[model samples]
Target: MTGVPASAAGGTGAKRVPAPKGKLGAAAVNQASLWNIANILTMVRLVLVPAFVVLLFQDGGYDPAWRAWAWAAFAVAMITDVFDGHLARTYNLVTDFGKIADPIADKAIMAAGLISLSVLGDLPWWVTSVILVREIGITLMRFWVIRLAVIPASRGGKAKTLAQGVAVGMYVLALTGPLATLRFWVMALAVVLTVLTGLDYVRDAVVIRRRAIVALRVAEAEAGAVEDSGASGDSASDEAGESAAAESTR
Candidate 1:
């Protein structure tokens, strides 16, 4: 950075020659291809979201056959969500596109499932509303702090997601007998985890945001000190040059 040409920094309407490998710039260099297998699977999940919704509503929405097929489609979408993340991490195939689209796909699919259930009388309206607020709020929080901090998903959050999928899946099946009790318990746990994890995420975001602001201030102060040191050095050099010239003239 120190040796970089001043001309490069102060160029006036002049196009600078870019490095050969920097055709798309430095950030793009590290970005993975959008068409990777992980991303494709994510897109497939998005497609299946609407499929799941349509299947859930088919034939007046109460038909046993329709519910069976709907559950199967939803199950497939959930399965893909598990693999897409694994594949992305394992293959280092994560891209900017994936980072954005993947979450949107996830939230969209989950929202469709929860909303559909509420609409079909399988879930209480208040439960759906609570979960939806948490889901949407946390998602917004992520983007809000994206520039200053990163809040990775916690184990509780992941468990909550799994719980939701399982609970919703069971409800779609309209299961009978002893399994109904099991479903009720699972759904209860899912709701509890959902609320808890939502609170946890909010707390984490607040802490991270505060720390980030502190870090930024420290960085700025250090930069200012560096600039001051550089300015002092230049002033000393100029004074030395002037003193020598005056002595020679005397």
Candidate 2:
């Protein structure tokens, strides 16, 4: 239920997750206003970030009641993250703003969750650091190679996001005994997936970037060859005309 939109996924990966059903649908979605339901859902997630953070720290940051409220806020944000992308794709409500804002909202909430947990000493700093670096680094990598090609989201990427959301959500609450130990293992798996998926993205970006560069060079070379051929023909025609004129004058 919680994941990044394929459209905005540098981490989620390239090629929109749900393909527009038809050409008309695609066109309509592209032209949809920024204020559509999908974009609004994204905006809602953005607003919830601060609300979740505030609630997380309330009542000395350890009160179960306050943590429950914070978890509610986080849950709402995650729920909206899912609905926004689905509605946008299914109803042809996609917009440029949605594409840009959706992922940002996703990252913002995750960052808030991780940082707050770390700050409260509930989660270790290194765990948060590793995940954040992967998330942020892959995000930056997406923009870097965007002009060349989009990297499609792999199954691994989806798994990574799910593991992360579940892990973080578990941590958001005050768990005990078996549940607490379970969360640690889940977080461990999330970390592993995070690192593996990150390396995969790096490899894909490099490959795609290389292919784009090679394609561009080949196109340029062919165009230059065509121009050279045209020039040679023009020069021959000119010489022929001059010879004919000289022969006629003689």
Candidate 3:
């Protein structure tokens, strides 16, 4: 009761509560729906991945025409990744499902494309292996680190994605004779960006781990202090009540 205001006491003198605005109204709107345009885009991206893989591996060879189609599909899927997040923020369409599904879809599409390209001998297996390992490792790290800190996409990560897109697109185009020479250059750029971005991610994970340890220690200290304070307060209150009762009896 020491911390409680007089108005909060059970009495007729209580003041009327003020009408809530802004965030309260926004929260009401947020609770109304979970589906939105961003989620639709994510679903579309997921649907496109299989079709793109089919195109990439059709006819037991990388047919130039199918490769072209695959490139288009991959490009569209990548664009949807960007658009989905943008639409989510712009339209306030964020949802837990969207957050979960979006990354899964992205990883699936990337894995399919990379594996197909590696199988087709369009890109070096070593390059794909390194990229795949980094992607999977970082994803797992993200899950672990999220308990303590947020891991938003860094600029280097975006650049790495762009580099991969260009590399894959060029590799697909290389199925046609005219673009074959450019494929190696694009892939080389991609490899460089991938290695740098992977290192950056590893560094970020280390920092996140350190921060998480610190956060856990701080949280434990705070919880212990709260428990100590609560116990002391209760003991003191009991003694005061006993003293008052003894005085009244006397």
Candidate 4:
């Protein structure tokens, strides 16, 4: 048998794959540049957590000077949290990475600070426990639903963060002598706000969960329909081929 030409065999007939297109390509590009200002702030918050821990435990066990430094570090971290969002919204720099990292950073710092203080006997264990449970629970919930729909931070969530920051700050300041009673009162108000905000987050989570369930069901139904349509098309093409074969035989 004559040898097949190289071009006919494989040289020039190979298909050229086109570059990626549409929303998938766009999403890939977006994901590639996920790091931004908000993410940087989140990283800063994470870094401050260890510093706060060291100040609370290793460096200067709730001493006035150390406490002041701790408070300042915490304040700066919290301030970055606020500014990151402001910059993200104002400058249109919001990214999926920022959305994920910001809350995680908040929870990490708050948990570290609260846990350290509780260990040091500054904060009551029950109070820290409640806050920690809520924070951790909500964070898990957020992760579970993140793939379906992004749950933006609610107003109550923001208030909760503010209350926590203020309360923790006052508690740290209380380590110093000046205005100890005033700081105690401030902390009490912060506690009240914290409780209210916690409840609000619970309510918001319930709504988000319900919405996520609905979205999931809708997506599943759509996917199933597409699969069924594809199967039907395959069946029709097979039937058409059989009919053509019969006609040729006839």
Candidate numbers sorted by TM-score from highest down: 2, 1, 3, 4
Which should have the higher TM-score, number 1 or number 2?
A: 2
Better of 1 and 4 by lDDT: 1
**Candidate 2, poorest ten consecutive residues by summed lDDT:** 10-19
- Candidate 1 residue pairs in clash (backbone atoms < 3 Å): none
Q: Candidate 1 or 2, higher lDDT?
A: 2
- Using lDDT as the measure, the top candidate is 2
- Model 4: worst 10 consecutive residues (lDDT sum): 23-32
| lDDT (Cα, 0-100) at 8 in candidate 1 | 65
For model 2, which pairs clash?
Answer: 13-153, 14-151, 14-152
Task: Assess every candidate by TM-score.
Answer: 0.84, 0.86, 0.78, 0.67
How far residue 199's Cα lies from its native spot in candidate 2, in Å, is 0.5
Residue-level lDDT tens digits of model 3 in 44-93: 99999999988888777557787788889999999999999887776567
Estimate, for each residue in 207-238, the C-alpha lDDT of model 4 and write its tens digit: 88798899889999999999999999999999
- Whole-model lDDT values for every prediction: 0.87, 0.91, 0.82, 0.76
Query: What is the TM-score (0 to 1) of candidate 4?
Result: 0.67
lDDT of 1 by residue, 1-250 (tens): 5786667676565578766454244335444577877889999999999999899999889888999999998998899999989877765678888888888888888889889988988889887888889899999999899899899989999999999999989988868899878988998999999999999999999999999999999999999999999999999999999999999999
* Candidate 3 pairs with clashing backbones: none
